[model samples]
Target chain A: MQQTLEQKPPVSPKVSAPPMAPTFSIPEPAQMPVSADYKTVGVPLVENAKFAMRDVNVFYGEKQAVFNVNLDIGENEVIAMIGPSGCGKSTFLRCLNRMNDTIDICRVTGSIQLDGEEIYASKMDVVPLRARVGMVFQKPNPFPKSIYENVAYGPKIHGLASRRVDLDEIVETSLRRAGLWEEVKDRLDAPGTGLSGGQQQRLCIARTIAVSPEVILMDEPCSALDPIATAKIEELIAELSQNYTIAIVTHSMQQAARVSHRTAYFHLGKLIEVNDTQKVFTTPDHALTEAYITGRFG
Target chain B: MESSVLLPVLALLCALAFVAGRSRSLAVAGVGGMRILNSLPFYYGSLTAFWCALPSLAVVLIWSIFDGVIIENMVHALVPPAAVEAAGGNIGLVMNQVRNLAAGHLSADSVEPAIAAAADRLVALERINRWALTGVALSFALIGAILAWLKINPQLRARAKVEDIFRWTLLACASLAILTTIGIVMSVLFESMRFFSKVPVTEFLFGLEWSPQTAIRADQQGSSGSFGAVPLFAGTLLIAGIALLVAVPTGLMVAIYLTEYASPRMRNLIKPVLEILAGIPTVVYGFFAALTVAPVIRDMGVNLGLDEWLTISSESALAAGLVMGVMIIPFVSSLSDDVITAVPRSLKDGALGLGSTRSEVVKLVVIPAALPGIVGSVLLAASRAIGETMIVVMAAGLAANLTANPFDSVTTVTVQIVTLLVGDQEFESAKTLAAFALGLVLFVVTLGLNYFALYIVRKYREQYE
Candidate 1:
């Protein structure tokens, strides 16, 4: 019990000692260790932060989806958010670029800053902000255009390419970085959607990078892909970590371990733990995190 | 007995057959119950029901159809060859007069003794035919029911047999609908052929002058009718083109605004309002076109002093086209809106995630994705505009002027067809039969347009799936 006390941070609730549960059967809310007022455990802060969130709360209509949470994405770092379905990990990821603004009834109350600039400010425009923070989704959604146009979509919209030659070069370079230029070079005029699933996702990634973004937020980028396709994406993610900051929300714990440097685990709208990937998988600080990692419960 | 009454009696026998077949199948199954039976009792019941009804219905229908001709042949036998030859051996003419006499619609004094004697024979033969028909049909129904009852055993493949009958019944109904369409088309084709016999096909197809006014009597003075349909075709294309011009942009904008911009409350309020525009009778639009829009356009043209370029008639094509465009806005909006809304969410989000604005996403991703379906919708709308008759009839005047100008009075094929059939004219005239020829052309054009729309829509569906 003393060791358990040491396990918890100072922000643990004052109502009672940390709650404990038996080995097998599902428990009541009271037996759950995490409190409503819980502050995120482990290293949720960093010095070289590219994106940071503080006291964030998200609601879909009357239902609170994400409770108060604080976390930071370091510069050029890969952080994977792992959680059960409807745990608000995706919602939390969307706050970085204010992507949730598109959802009509979803309301977010928090201070989300990118490069010390508050992204959720009323004055900030999402177009430029999103141009800086590109996103890849769970499904490989390539635009219904030829491969050349699909990669050129971002640069054209942003006016980054003054000439057709410039656009072509950007397309080739972006696809090269995404590791897709070799296979698709012969068929640049072919429809982007006609490509294989893995290729399509990589095309989306190339399209994202063509605008030269500072950060890439991916929501389960490899979930729809086959195992080989997923491994290729993991490798791409590893290579991409050298140049761009990435915040990925993934269902696969092993994927988080394989690609991300730091992993954040959320449960029931609260952040239970965020730590170095190896520490989280080997010796998690929070008992709830251990319970989740060992497959006791999501 | 009336065949309508016979139908009910046969239906009652079918019900009895259903019960008998069910019980017999149960008896066949014995202590083993339904487990050992090839099919359930339900299948046996329906199988017997169909057997009892179908064969008897077929026989009764065929008998009723041919009995009139058979009895008429018997009546013809009653009349001597001399009387038939005097009537030019016209069996139909003699039959009509004989039928009128039998019904007492014509006096016996007006006809010769041979004709009167034949009319009496017609009445007797008809009475005998009815009794014989009822006897044969009822016996067939009873025999069918008994045969079906005897065939119902545990080993019988009652389910499969019943299913086969159902499939054939559905196929029969489908064929009937298609056959009726073909029959109507054939009648039109034959009449058009008669019209072509009077006027050359090339002249009707490519001639610009369309003065279809022919002399009423042999000595009467009138213009020799020239059935040049080009002027009518040009007017249709012009008006339909103008309508498309007005409808396509406005309707596409409405669709985009609804799908990409409108709030749920606004969408709900606006969509039904647009549909109400569609539901408003084209006749009502005709009234609006003729009374309101046409005069307004003429006055506006006068105010603008546009007479320097072209004259503006009260029945200008612009007015009809504009009002027609309004009438079709709901169609364009409804159909295109369905496709636009069906633009996959992932595609929209992908563009959005790339930092593109809503309008940019719509322009670059959503619209391009849905373009084939949108073009299909526009084609469908064009077909409707081309086929629209009431507005053109009321607003567009019946002047077959082969001019490209919209301000001049011009007439469409639909309007010409309407005018040709509206008043006192004999069906034998090329002028009257010209309506059927025009109808055939319009049918082919609309059929082509509809087929193209379906093909494009199917192509768009394949892209997404």
Candidate 2:
């Protein structure tokens, strides 16, 4: 049998050579070894917590996206979630304000509390809840109205201001807090979409803060901007963190280190590590976190 | 040679030129020298083919279009002056005799001798013209193929030349529609000019009465019919206004419900059902308007105790306008739904994330963004409503009545035009010519509305991107 096997003709490759010059070969990547029994390694809980989530599992149709995540975000703190693409960081942040409820196929089962009040209660309305916790998206989305109207839209709809001057004051104050009043004050009646990319994001932030939310969620708000625009947004975030609790999702580790107080590393929909930002960057507690920050594999 | 055989030969020659050009380039470049070529081998082949085909096809087209006129003029020159003098210097009649005798449509025994000689000359010139066309077209095709095929080389910019040809081809295709539109406008203008010559423009424009009666003899009654068009214009505006009132609100609500409120599964099932209304023929809608809606409206008015002043006529503007509104619903809702759906998801989410309810987001954010596009759709629907004729002719009466009341019997411009030109009538009569004048007015109005709609839609497109 060994002689017959050795005498068999060599099998040809299934794919023929391309018609042009042959391409250079690249070696295949080695398979990464990720153990299944890993747990959350670093400090997942915090003191004076503003948001407390326990055993959160998110699913779309039958496919589970986030698996049993437990985390806490403290008051007046900025926490950054970092991971490779499609690791459920954005999915976890959307669950805070029940924004996932808009998607018909998405289902979330967990206990999420904001200021010790259940957000996913049977009778809870998303309107008032969203007012208390506003969000800034990856892309700058301004209403196709005047610049002043962009800032005044929320106040007008929520009836926060009783008089026209009061509404004017609210718009001015929000724009001032967002650091965009100086650049856009003269063009109050110009269309909001006519602003530059960075200015538009600042306008979006001002639009968000008009409602006085306690916590602000930002999903890679600087991803669409240039480096100079990104620096301005980072400066804005640092100043805004003093007044409100913030949660940010980022693909850049340097951005996480620069702006966040705490950093959480997620892998394959699992919460791998959470700790102080300096410690998470310098000396991570989990092997996967070390591999990610050290650029071994992503 | 017959053109049927000549055309196929020209096509085959172009194909051969493509192959010859490719082979010549390959032979000059050698195996490894293809890397040094300016463009791909396929571009060279296309260059050769275009050069061979386009000039040959142009020659054939020009020949086909003007060949008869040139041959007829040559045959007319061959006719004797005595033949023309015998026919009272009527050249048209003399030419007709020549063409008939040449085709054996007339007998030469009864015809004049000079006309028979002209007929023989006519037949000979036509046969010779056919031969010249075949010979000249073939020589041009062959010379073009040879020149293009011999010019193929490694360093030739065949790709750029081919792209230049493509640019002109695309320009020709794009201008075809514009040219056709200009042709239509010019024809309508000239006919309306003729109509205005017979009747004064002031009487047609400012006269309030509109009775166009054609009297064949001198002693007939109503010989000179009145041509006032104010009542027709008023009736058109009344019907169109009512149609807009019915269509704008209902179609907008349907679009808002579909885009903002309905689920995807429900949208899929309902959108096609709505578009089915658009697919129904206008003639079908006309009968439906006449048989069903008219009687119901008349009865409702009678039952409400309105017999003399407020009573709806059996053929009233309200019935026609209401049905026309229903007929144009798909145009409004479909276009409005597209613009509303085009409102970015980020804008809607931005509003909702700021504590605004779903309805508030739609009302404040979505509607304001899509407003210009909605107006464009409404204007387009207005044009459709104005140009509509069958339903008005069936459900609305022909008697032109000037009133703002929808219950009164009225006639629109399109209905009047249709009534004036339906049967066998004297094309030279003022009554028949009035139809062309009304057609010109209707054309101008609809064209202006369409142009405004396009401008608005373009402005909306710039707002987003």
Which residues of candidate 1, in runs, are more than 4 Å off?
A1-33, B1-4, B80-91, B454-465
**Candidate 1 positional error at B44, Å:** 1.4
Tens-digit lDDT string for candidate 2 (B180-265): 99998898788889889999989888889888886879799988888888889888988888888889888998999999899999
TM agreement with the true structure for every prediction: 0.93, 0.86
Model 2, A68-101: lDDT tens digits are 8899999999999998888889999999988898
User: Which pairs of residues clash in candidate 1, taking residues 3 or more apart in a chain or in different chains?
Assistant: none
lDDT of candidate 1 vs native? Answer: 0.91
The candidates score, on chain A by TM-score, as follows 0.90, 0.88
Candidate 1 structure quality by residue, lDDT tens digits, B166-202: 8998999999999999998999899999999999999
Global lDDT of each model? 0.91, 0.89
In order, what fnat does every candidate score? 0.70, 0.72
Tens-digit lDDT string for candidate 1 (A1-298): 9999898877647866666765676564325866789988899999999988899999999999999999999999999999888888999998888889889999999788999999988899999999999999999999878899999999999999999899999999999999999999999988888999999999999999999999999999999999999999999999999999999999999999999999999998899899999999999998788878888776
Q: B118, model 2: CA deviation in Å?
A: 5.5
DockQ of each: 0.51, 0.52
Top candidate by TM-score: 1
Residue A197 displacement in candidate 1 (angstroms): 1.1
Quality of candidate 2's docking, in CAPRI categories? medium
